[model samples]
Target chain A: MTRPRVTFWRLFIVASLALGAYSIFVRFHEGIGGATNLSDGTPWGLWVGLDILTGVALAAGGFMITAVVYVFGLERYRPIVRPALLTAFLGYLFFVIGLLVELGRPWNIWHAIIYWNPNSALFEVAWCVMLYTIVLALEVSNLIFERFGWVRLSRVFHAVVLFLVIAGVMLSTLHQSSLGTLFVIAPGKMHALWYSPALPLIFYVSCMCAGLAMVMVEAFLSQRFLKHPVRVDLMARLARVLMIGLMLLTLLRFSDLWLRSALPLAFQPTEEALAFWVEVALFQVIPIVVLWPERRRASPRRLFVGAFSAVAGLVTHRMNVATTSFVSSSPTDYFPTWMEFSVSIALVVAGVVVFWGFAKWTPLFAEGEHPPHAAHRAEHVTRARPGPPTAISGCGRARRGARRLPAPRRWPGGRSTAPGTRC
Target chain B: MSKGMLIDITACTGCRACVNACRTKNRLDAPPGARLSETDFTVLEHRDRLAVRRMCYHCNDPACASACPVAAMVRTPEGPVAYDEHRCMGCRYCMVACPHGVPAFEWHSRMPRVRKCAFCPDHVAEGRPPPCATACPTEATLFGDRDALIKAATARIDARPERYYPGIWGRDVAGGTSVMFLSPVPFDRLGLRTDLGPDPLGHATGRILALVPGTAATVVTVLGGTYWLYRRRAAVAAEQALAAARDGADAAAREGREGGR
Candidate 1:
């Protein structure tokens, strides 16, 4: 059988390459010193805060997808694995580029790799990212190989896939949260409300939440582009994630406050404390409202809103942690430069392009397999009958990826295997 | 023994001459971005009316040195927190973990790194005043031996009990800093974060978290290797499944033909 068409891969490549090139020019011309707002008092800026730290957290969907589908045997994510892994792949690509642009002595970056001291926190992030990107590329490349009639090679490769999946998960688990640990040393520099010994733990947990939110965006966009309805079950799963993220974030906030027990002043006529509380309320409290059992069943739109809100909350959290929290004493307070912002914009465009190519080419939206279930339900009241749906099975790359379920072939539901039912 | 400086905020007038002098001496560009990256070696942070000139508060057990997985930030026996750019991966964990947020990332450069005060050890080695100290017209930012500086700080605090804070900023903070602060108000009030506990973050987390990098390395290589292997296995199973499927199809086709005959 012929493969599906990928209309936009070329366009995506061109756009991503162009954006990267532009950012490279900006990075070189300004020099990290002159272009960024980082000061002697505050050396770190938004590129570190948002792009490197939060960006990695948001891209966690790939690990989460693979983990659920492979390790936990959650078959539902099979359809999402390829796309997730691909996104994870590109996310790391952008991350590497961003770092290169940020580095002052970009030429000497290899020195750190070769002459590792094994005592720096950054060395850990560097090596982990370096290794993890390779893992991601390798994982995603299998699909390309599978599609290209290299089935035998892919077979040889499958022997260690599980081990790789497990390792990828472990590395992601460590590095994702370590982004937060970056701030743990700043107990004195960070505002009291934002600083805590539990920062590493908090960071880890927040990324998990961010991962879900990221997938929610993925699911939402996939639905929008594919013109397929987002699954109610998927929304249910997302709501569950939001509930856990927001609840734990709330718990952590309160616990940190309780430990210090001087948090009251943070909420009173003070700008800093107010920023803290507002972030909590916006990012956490409101999202939990619609995640209740009663609400989860009633609406998908509500779920979408909840996910978006949580994502917003997560972004704000990153900004606060990276910027607002350390506003005092640190002379450097960061705002994104034009090139930095442009590059970030380019990243979003790249994600769209990737999503577009995946949707157009892959079996991700195939009819018998990837039928629009939500659409059927939405128009169920008016349609006399709905067409046959595909059966998707398999445990890893598919959600029940290759599971062969008998499609209903009956009229008014009478007997017969519907024609062209194989998926 | 390595010498140090103790800043008695009681003496500082926020003159900022030291900030200019260090920048001039180091040839650091005027801060174009945020205030921190603009200057090097010496910088100023203002809280309310008090000014704190911050450089490197090199510690006896510096958190940056310990937090570095690559040992980029090394602590000298004499107590200077020196950075080796060649060994830095630009992860900025030191910037995040520093109690004073002293470690700064050169965020704009392609080969950026963590930059912070190195105690002007070169000049100090020559038995000359550190640039900032020599530049301080008001003598607000001072330099001396570690023991002598603390003794002088204590003497000042003792002689003018009402004028200075009851406690020293760095003597007990993070196991003692090469640079100490003297303030009229409490260190906490001036936004000179003193909340970091007596134990350096390195001692508190190094043993357990240091494994993070090595563990990460092991996990990445192992996982990368494993994933490659897993894909191969799945492909073999798939081929086997396909063969079984074809044989089943052929058998069914034969039966239908035989029945028709």
Candidate 2:
């Protein structure tokens, strides 16, 4: 393998990490008042809004992709599953880290685990987030175990993998919606343009779209970096799914406004109205326009544009709902301090760096029948040649069993090599 | 049986004695700036010469108590909503959930806690008026049974209809706060919200959340069934493949025997 070189992006991430470390120190040493623009009026600033909320919202793709592959039995989407799982696991890890930093007493955060508060929406969110992260860790560990040739452990993980996926989907559904439930209490504080009894439902649906979009965007980035071929057709199909979700969200939100006599509020010339329009136009409208056409869907770049647009829109929607909408009602205005921004940016960079590192080490994109690395590939080839007993008879038996198993239909993409065949 | 306070805003002199009394009683330092803080729970707001004391309303159905994940903020039987600093993890959900925005967080503290008026639990437990009420020489804030305070407020309103706004704040706002208000001008003009409905803010979400058990059961059943079906199909396919391979091997052996004969 070629030695990894010092790239601009890598240098940028290192510098950001250094700055982020200092900002985090300031946060701990000086407290929130010194490090953040949060106040009595605006208690939840960019940390809660951008870091935690948006972080979880973007991580929705993990459950979505896992459900698509495992539950729905879509064999074609298997290639993207590990990457999605890795992204989600990292996304949630950083979310927890952000929660620790944003929280006033980070040590006391575990109280939610020991103490039961069935009444609080945040309690539900806290529980679900904790449980789902555990599930993701188990799911993603399949790749890690496979990397180290831990066959017995990998077999054990597979034995309960489906159940874990179902539980993840259920927990994800609960908390993704409950994040909206956090805002349900602040009806007076939240703008009518965003607030509704159906916020949970809206949030649930939009997150599904956000998750799918994230998977699409991540798939493109991963394919580019990992030297894997782009599955444009599969991504186009995913875009269609995102479009359906976006349409449902747009319909639900506007009709909800109409029923509540708040539709006129959207048309009014105000910042909230403009923000609402921007969210709709950028995320909901533009993606629908770009991905709706068959010709547009055929282009890989177009698919990415649609996905990125939806991702950006979903992020903006969460930020607007969480922070921007409350500004008018708040006693003091809020803009994130430089330290707050640095910490948030650093968290994202950290996630990407971790993902990059994992992809380099693990067989995240390899088919289940095959292990990664040229050495592993050579070993599999020798085992497949029916001449003599392989030195490792156990590996040989495993290879024979894998070959006997029914291979899924060869997907139409470049480098379509059978498992155990040298690529 | 819960105690409450009826603050007649028209009678207040804007002297801020209640604010001073609360700080002195709680032994909390007065942070600079007149805004509410961890130290200063009560603030006297003057709007066009009419003064009103702004603090935690100590609602009969307090949103903060319901929003608190650990029950750190709980309503007392004696009527004041109090905070247990020991139990507090300080997630500050109460701050977000408060319609009145009464709960203030200790942003500067290393070991932070949520801060708000507890309606003087020591005074309520001892059958004495809260410090603020005790300090009000004008009887602007009268402490008694909630029903009695409501009756007195109605009688006062009926006696001189022109002196009041004709609506008592917190009578039904957020399902009746322990601290009710009377004003000459509108409640909104005094930095109080009038738009909050009678229902508890936490009730709707709680009702939806109550269905989670049923939702979980249904999800498990559906997914479990799907898993079973997928496993069954894989098993059936493997069996069929084994049967076909056996038939081919037997036919190849028979052909070889015939050729040898």
Candidate 3:
């Protein structure tokens, strides 16, 4: 009954939480002025730039995965549905937490529900995000019910799961585009390199890429750390979708620039221009290069790198849109204080911890009847851990050599039954 | 009728009386910078020899009102974009959406609210001129009917064509703001944004948002139909397989019975 030994990741998370707690104290005690470097000209800073915007974009995977599995009937992806939902739910929960820290009057946030401004795009986004969080909670409750052996509750959830999923998809679509719509009023404030009338379309398309890439990254991480059996074919299929999304996003973005006669701005020796190009390289060029190879594309590590690159690119893009785009118009130079950065980093660590905890406690990767590794699935352990592991020993075992545990029945590179096909 | 202000930069001395009057009238702190803040609603700035007073334009179709998620900032019929601190959620979208960068935040305070000029609606309600306007010695900041102000602004530019800039700022920019400016130099040179077109800033975003309902309905129908079709086909396949298995079992039993007979 001894707790697992603490690893570097666990130690890092703990340290971050402690440091961030102090900053949170300062923020509440002394107000935003003491904790952040934000001014009247630069009111939205790291919290809006990284924590809320990028966080929400990354969470897009939940709706996409649910749509693929439930609406399209892609049963192959059923294994990853719960994990995707968990990641999204945690992402959004932390997003709201970050917003609370950022908002001057967080207590009045519920006012958005009571007062409706039909003309305001932020109003739409606020409403959709609020509603979607509820929808996601309901969608994700099935796993919790099953884990607790609430058979009747689980049955009720199943009956309404499809309705919840449909509502989620609709809500996500509204807010995902609405985030971009928030910037439309700032045509003069935002640099020409990032501003366009087609911003909503660009945002929607890029969200698809972010969502697909995040799903791939999640699938790879669970396979790596949780020691879930590898499903290379599934990852490969998702990669293809990610690649297609990246291409469409690139095409749309470049076409927008070209049509607006803003293409010249991209070549300028300015910070905004350089950032734009970096976004293109990370989100568009690198992922395309990595996923182009049939063999390498199927490799779990390679796919993961590509997916991570795409996610990173999208994060940068969102940050650019939210904060960097306004730099030219800002009265003073803005850089986030250490306290702000720590708070953001802490939120991420908190999210990761919650995701890892949920994966361990619930049947996130309990592969179903048609699992590739049916033997392994048959031996699946539903035994609840006495308490949470202080750290993952799986990482250590992975480093020492994977010889400690039984090898997966099949590797992604080959069919296990065919000797010659094994890589 | 809606009111307005016409500020003639050429007539004003850099005495800053209007700035002081604004602070005293609004009960705000004496701020150091020429920019608007929670404590500073209006600031008197100098461009070479010309003295200019800066504050909210109070647009006919206010972008801040449009961008406010909770309608905390509302444009009144009397030509003021008023803010209700009690209704504010502190989202700061209004600050970002304002074309003139007029809205300021109470960043230093724990319970902050958006701070901006409301065109001195209290005085206008009493059928009196705004404090800034009344305090101006040269009538540099004129307050009256929006139409009369525009006509006067145009006449000044036309009568002394060599002394004034041709365009009357806020006459059409951002859908004709209630506060207009007449300057000797170009409006941009005087720190006013001339880039905003006549149409309201919210119009573009509004058009895009209008598509949401139709798009959502379409998606729901299409996706729902797809799910229904897929489920029905799966159910049909299952039923056929069950029937086939039963028929094979019945035939095998009959054959065994016939052989025994």
- Choose the strongest candidate by DockQ: 2
Return the lDDT, model 2, position A176: 93
Predicted complexes: DockQ each: 0.24, 0.51, 0.44
Cα deviation of A35, candidate 3, in Å: 1.3
What is candidate 1's local distance difference test score?
A: 0.67
TM-score of chain A of each: 0.78, 0.87, 0.86
TM-score of chain A of 1: 0.78
Please state the CAPRI-style docking class of candidate 3. Answer: acceptable
Which sections of candidate 1 miss by over 4 Å? A1-24, A33-36, A262-266, A269-274, A294-298, A331-339, A362-423, B6-40, B43-54, B67-71, B85-97, B101-117, B126-145, B148-169, B180-193, B204-261
When 2 and 3 are scored with DockQ, the better candidate is 2
lDDT of 1 by residue, A323-368 (tens): 7777775654556666666666666666667666756664343322
Q: Show model 3 residue runs off by greater than 4 Å.
A: A1-5, A367-369, A372-423, B242-261
Q: What is the lDDT of residue A314 in candidate 3?
A: 93
How far does residue A185 in candidate 1 sit from its true spot (Å)? Answer: 0.6
DockQ of 1: 0.24
lDDT string for model 2 (A202-232, tens) is: 8899888998899999889877666667789
Per-residue accuracy of model 3 over B59-113 as CA lDDT, tens digit each: 9998889999999999999998899998898888898898888898877678888
